[model samples]
Target chain A: MDKKKNISMAVIKRLPKYQRYLREMLNNDIDRISSKELSEKIGFTASQIRQDLNCFGDFGQQGYGYNVADLYKEICNILGLTKQYKTIIIGAGNIGQAIANYTNFQKMNFDLVGIFDTNPKLCGLKINDIEIRDIDLLGEFLKENNVDIAIICVPSRSAQGICDMVVKGGIKGIWNFAPIDLSIPKEVIVENVHLSESLLTLSCLMNGAI
Target chain B: MDKKKNISMAVIKRLPKYQRYLREMLNNDIDRISSKELSEKIGFTASQIRQDLNCFGDFGQQGYGYNVADLYKEICNILGLTKQYKTIIIGAGNIGQAIANYTNFQKMNFDLVGIFDTNPKLCGLKINDIEIRDIDLLGEFLKENNVDIAIICVPSRSAQGICDMVVKGGIKGIWNFAPIDLSIPKEVIVENVHLSESLLTLSCLMNGAI
Candidate 1:
C-alpha cells in the first residue's frame, strides 16, 4: 500500500462512499467488484473511481477489479476506523442528543466518552447511560480524558465560544453542527454539517433550480 | 444572469458555503465583500469563489465588491428558499424528534407539517406542540397535506422501505438521515445525511491519513 500525501479534497470526499458501498457489497456476499460495476452502482465514472482509489495504492488491477474484503479493510485503515477513537459531544441539545444516540460510531470503535451541555437544567441528565456534564468542566474533562474528536451541537450564538473552548481544551478535530463557520488553525480540521444546506439543496432540486 | 444549465455538482456544493459566509458578513454589519475577501474568509480560492458565484450571475465585478444582503437574498432565491416549503418527518425517533424541534427550518420557510412513527407508544407524544402520527397513515396524510419534502429519520434496516413509502405517498424531495442509501426514481432527489461519514472524515484527519 502507498502512503497518501496531500490528497485532493475531491478524492477524500469519495473515500466514505467507497467504504459504504464496499460494506454493502460485503454484506451481500459479493467478494469482488469491478470499476465498471462500481461506477454503475455509484453513478461515478469508472475512471473516476479508479483514480480516486489509485491515490492510496495500486490494489486493483486493470481487469480483475478489487477484492471486496481487502478494499474495505484498506479503506477502513485509510479512514482511521481500524482503531478505536474516543469521541465526545458538547451541548446535549436535540442535535447533540441525536448524535449521542448514533450507535454506528460506537459500533465502528468511535467511543462516546462524554456529553456536556451549557443548559443548567440538563447538567445532571443522562442519555445512553452517559451523564450530561456541565460545560464549565469541559476544559478539565478534556485535560483528563483522551478525546480524539469533539462534536459541537450548539446554536449559532454560542457555537464559536464553545468551539474556542473546545480548541483551548485541546481537541484537534471538530464535527460541528452549528450554523456558523468556525475559524481554526490549519492543523485542526473542522467538519461543518449544515442541515440547512441539505434542505436547500432539496429545495433547489424540487424547484428545478440547479 | 445565467439559466444555470448543467451547473457542476462542485459548484452546487459551494452554494451553501457562499450563502453561509454572506449571512455571517451581514450579521457582522459587513455589507460588502469581494471575491478575494470571500476567499480569505472561506479558505476557497478567489477565482473559485468568483467562478462559483458567476455560475448564478455576474454578482461581483473586477473592482467592486458584492453587497452582502443583496447577495444573500439572491442566493436564497437561487436555492428556492424564498418560498415556504411544507415538510414531513417519518420515524419520530431521536433524529426525527430532533429535526421537528429544529426551529431553524421554520426560520428558512421550510415548515414542518407532520411527524410520524411506527411505534404506537410515540404516536401521541409531542415536541414543540406537534404530536407524532402513525406511519401507516403516512400515505393518507401526504395525500391531504402539502408536504414538499419528506425527512426520513428511520434506521438503516427500515429506511429503504420508509423511503419507498414516502415516494409512493407523493412527496418528491427527500432528506434522508438513515445510514443506508435509498434507491429512488431518477426524478426524485434523495439527500443522505450520513453522520458516520463526517465522523470518519474527522477520524481520517485525526489519523493524518487523508
Candidate 2:
C-alpha cells in the first residue's frame, strides 16, 4: 500500500473507540448519528471525528449524518472483524484458559481453533469445548492448520521462545499477554496486552496526576 | 487542582509508556536518560517527554538528564503505586482467578487482599495464597478492611451489579475486566480493560489499515 493510503496509527487507534460507540448505538437501535452527537457521546470534537471518519471514505451525508449500521459495518471491515481469524493460545494456564473462555472474541470473529500447553495433564483437558494439546505438537499443528494469530499466555521468560516458534511457523499476528516486548519482523504484527499498564494509568489519575 | 496543574489525559495516558521504558532502563542498569534517548526508546518526541515530566516536577537538567531510578520511583509515586493498594477481585471465574495469580500486581504494589465469587463452590479455593471468599461478604469486608481498588472480573451481564455494589461499598478505583461499559458515580474512577479492543487494533494493523 502507498503511504497516502496507509492510515495513520492515531486514526487507526480511534477506530476501536468509534466502533465501540457504534456498537452501543446499534444495540440501542440508534440508526443514525451526526458527528456532533458522536462527539457528545465519545468526548472527541465533532471536527476531529469528522476528519477521522473522512480518512476512510464518505460515510456521512449533509443532513442525514451517518447511518449507524453502515458506519459500524465499514469499521468492522476496516478492522478485519468481518473476516474470521483462526487463533491459538500458547499456554493453558489461568490467563490462557481465561482467554479461551472469553466470548467477546468470538463476537469479534476471532475463532479459537486450538489451545496448547506444556503440561501433559492439561493437554487433554477441555476449556469451552477446545481440548488443550501438547505444546510439542504446536509446530506441527501450526504447519498443518491455518492459524492467523498466536495468543501468548505464557510467562515472561518463555514468551520470546514461543514468539520465535510461532513466527517461524508462519503466524502473521501475535496477541501477547506476556509482560515482555517481543522482537519480531516488521511483516509480523504484535499487540502486547499489558493489564498493569491500564492499572497504572488509573493509579496516576487517582493519585492526582490528572 | 487548578486547570494549569491538572495534567491532560493525553499526558496521563503516556505515563505508563514512560514508566515501562523507565523500568526497562533501570533493569539494564542505565543510570540516566536524556529526553532524546527516552524519545527514541518510547516513540514520544523529546519535547513531549520533557513537557510530560515537567508537569509533575523538575527531573531533567541542562546536560545530565533524568536519573533512571529516581525517575522510576517518581513515576511509581505519581501513579500512587508506591503506596500499597488493598485490592479485591470480584469474580472467581477464569479472568478473576487468573488476575489473582498475576505476579505483576504485587511487583507494582497492588496487594490482592481477597477474592470473592458468587458461586459457593469457588469459595475457599486458594489462588496464590489468597482464598476465595463468598461474594456476600464483599460489603462487610470492604467496611472492615481497606480496599482502594475493586477489580470487576465477572461476566458482562453481572458486571454492572457488581460495580454498583463495589462502588457502594466505598471503593475509589475500579479495574474492570468485563466487556461492558459500567455506569459509575462521578467519584469512582474506572479503567476498563477491554482485551478485544487490543485485538481489533492488531487486526486493523494486520489488515493493512495502518
Candidate 3:
C-alpha cells in the first residue's frame, strides 16, 4: 500500500505542526497525551486532531490518549518526512537567497543541493556555502546532480520560460514564487506561493471580514 | 448583513484568483460568463464556483450565466477589497525588501504606508521610496500612520517579539513569514506563511508519493 492514499494534502500540511508539538512533549518526557492536550498545544480542536489522525489506522487508546513518540513516528511516516529530500533553488535573487539562508529548510527534510541564477556575474556566489551556477547549465547540472525538486523564484515575466526549462530538465515538483499563473503538464506538480495574495488576505482579515 | 457570515477562509482565499480571471475577461470585453466558464479559466470545477458564489447570493440565473462586471463587484465586496487597507511591514531584510519592491501590492486595495526595522544601518534605507524606520518607533508609527495590517519578515528567533510588539501597537492583523508558531491574544489574527513547509510539500510530490 502506498502512503499517499492514507492522507490528504491538508492533512499532510498539518503533520509538521503535529510533529513539532509531539517532539516537545517527547523531550519533556510527557509520554501520554489526550486529544484535548494535543489540541491545545497545536491550536486545533480536540475533535479535529482525532479526526485527522483517525484517517490513518487507530493509534490512540480510548481513554489514555496517544503516546508522544509513537504519534510522532506515525505522523512522520504519513508526511514522508522521515527521509531527506534533495532540493535545488533556481533563482539566486533576494527571494531565492532568503530561502537558501532559511534554517527551517535544513531543519525540515530538504537538503539544499545547488542554487542557479541567470546572471553571469552572480555565478560562483555562495549562499551558506551552496554555490550558484549559471541557469544555462541547468539541464547538465540536473543530470549530474540528483535534484528532484526546483524552487522557482524568478520574475513573473521570466517564470514560464524558466518553468519550461525546469520541466524539461525532469524536475517533478516546483514551489513557484512568481506572481503569474503557470500551466505545467499534468505530470509536473506546481504550487504557487503568491506573497501578494497572502498579504491581501491579511488585509481583508484586518478589515473585519473574510 | 455582514460578508463574514457567509464565507469561509478557504473560499475567501480563492477570491483573488476569481478576480484575476474576471479582470482578464472584463479586459477582453467578456460581458457574460457561466460558472462553468469561470471554472475552466481558473482550473476549478463549475460546481465549486457555483457553490462558492451561492454562499454570497444567487448572482446567476438558473440556466443563463452571470454578468462579468456584476460578479466582479460582488466578489470584491465580499472580499472587502472595495475599501483600502493601510499596511506596514516589519524587518527590512531581503524578504522585506523584495515584498516592498513587488508592484502587485499596490495593484491590490492595500497600501504600504510604512516599514519598521531594528537595524540601525537599514533605518534610513528605502525600497520603492518607503523608508525603513527604527523598530523603537513602531508603536508611534502604527498610531500616527493609521497602519492596520503588518507583514512580519523578521528572523525566526525575533518573530515572536515583533508579533508581540505589533499586537501591542494596535495592529489587528499579521502576515508572518517567520516559521515559528506564534501565540497571540484573542483579538489579534495571524497568518503563518511557512516557506519551508511549501518546499517540503513540493519535495514530497516530486518523490511521487506523499
Candidate 4:
C-alpha cells in the first residue's frame, strides 16, 4: 500500500476494471490467471496489466500468474472496499432518486445514510425507505452523522453551493452527477459523472469513426 | 475534417469539455478569447488546448486568440451535435426512466423516440410522452424508427443480448449504462457509463490520496 504514493491517475482509473474482471473470474471458480490471459479478457495488453499491478507491489510469479482470489482481495483493499462509507445524496431529483433506489451501492459498503433536496414536496418522500430530508438540514445532518461521501445530484447551478456546504461540513469524497466541474480543495476527491459530456464523447467518436 | 482522421481518442474525449467551457463563455457574451485565457477557465494548459484544437483544424490565432462563438460551433460540428439523432432506451428501469424523462438530451438534439422494458407491468407507461414498449418489440421498433443511438440501461446479464439486438437493428452508437462491458462490432461505437466502476475509482482515490 505504501508503494501507491505517486501512481498516475491513468493507472488508478483502470484498477476498478481490473477488480471487476477479477471478480467475474472468481465467481466462475477461476483460481489463477496469467497476465496474457487476463489481458485478453480485460482488453489491456499483458505487459500493461503487469505494469499496472506492479504499481501497487510485486504480484504474480515467473510463470505461475496471479492468484485470482488474492488479487481480488488486494485490489479491493487498495480501493478501500473493506471499510464502510456513509453517503448522502443532495438533490433528490430523478437521478438522485434513481441512485437512492440503487441498493447495490449499499451492498458495496456505501451506505446511503440520508437524502436531501431543496423542493419542499420531496422532503418527506421515501426512496428505499430512506426519507428525503430538506436541503436546509444538510449541514446539521452532516454535523451529527459521520458522512464520508456527498453524492451531488443537484443541477449545475446549485452544485457548487451544495459542494461548498458539504465540504465545509467535512465531506472528503464527492460522486458528482452535475454537468459542471466543481471547484474543490486538494484534499477533497471529486468523481464526476458528466452525462452530457459522456454522451457528447460518444457522438463525437461515432461521427468521426464512421 | 480530413485532419480528424487519426486523432487520438484522448483528444476526442476532451472535445466535450472544451465545448462546455466555450458554451459558458458564449452564454456570458464573451465573443472571443486567447488560448491562455481559455486554458485557465477550462483547466487544460494553453499548449494542450492549442494542440487538441489543432487536431481538428487551425483554431486560435497566434496573438488574436479565438472567437468563442466560432470555436463552440466548430466543436459542435466535430461532435456531430449539428445533426439530430433519434435514440431509444432499452430497459425501463430506474436509470432508463430517468434518462427518458431527461429533456436535456432532447434539447441537445438526441431525441428519445422510444423506451422498452422486459417487465410486463412497465409497458405502456409513458415517460415524457414516450411510451415504454415490451422488450420483445425492440427489434421491430428499431426497424421502423431511424434510431441512431440505443441507451442500454439493462442489467449486466441482459445488456449484451440487448446490445446485439440494437446493433443488428442498425444502431451505430450505444450509450451503455450496464456495468458489464458489452462486446460490440468495430463498426459500432459503445460508450459506457459504468456507475459501479466510477464509485470504486472515487473510493480508491480517497483511500490512497488521504
lDDT of 4: 0.91
**lDDT, model 4, position B180:** 89
Q: Among all windows of ten consecutive residues in candidate 2 chain A, which has the lowest summed lDDT? A: A1-10
Per model, the share of native interface contacts recovered reads 0.72, 0.76, 0.43, 0.70
* Backbone clashes under 3 angstroms, per model: 0, 0, 0, 0
Give the per-residue lDDT of model 3 (tens digit) for B134-178. 999888886777677788999887999988888888887888988
Shift in Å, residue A146, candidate 3:
1.9
Off-target runs (Cα >4 Å) in candidate 1 are A1-3, B1-3
How would you encode candidate 1's per-residue C-alpha lDDT over A1-210 as one tens digit per residue? 235776887677778888999999999999999999999998789999888888887778867889989999999998988888778999898999988887777998989999999899999988899999998899999999978788999888888998888788788789999887887878888888989887877787777776
Q: Give the range of the ten consecutive residues with the poorest summed lDDT in model 1 chain A.
A: A1-10
lDDT of 4 by residue, B1-210 (tens): 556688888888898999899999999999989989988898999999988888867778888999888889989998999999999999888899889878999999998898999999999889999999999998898899899999999989999999999999999999999998889999999999999989999999888742
Candidate 3, residues A1-210, lDDT tens digits: the string is: 454476678876776678767877888999999999888878899999998887766877999999788888876665567777677888887789877887667787778898999888899989889899998888898888776678888988799998888888888778899877887998988877888667656655655644
TM-score of each: 0.94, 0.89, 0.89, 0.98
User: How would you encode candidate 4's per-residue C-alpha lDDT over A1-90 as one tens digit per residue?
Assistant: 456687888988898999999999999999999999999999999999999998877778878999999999999998999989999999
Better of 3 and 4 by DockQ: 4
Candidate 3 residue B109 Cα shift, in angstroms, is 3.8
What are the chain B TM-scores of all models?
A: 0.94, 0.92, 0.93, 0.97
For residue A132, model 2's alpha carbon misses the true position, in angstroms, by 2.8
- Please give the distance, in angstroms, between residue B157's alpha carbon in candidate 1 and its true position after superposition: 2.1
Residue A89 CA error for candidate 2 (Å)?
Answer: 1.1
What's the CA RMSD of model 3 in angstroms?
A: 2.8
Candidate 2 local lDDT, A88-130, one digit each (tens): 9999887998899987788778999999999988989999999
Q: What DockQ class does candidate 1 belong to?
A: medium
**Which pairs clash inside model 3?**
none
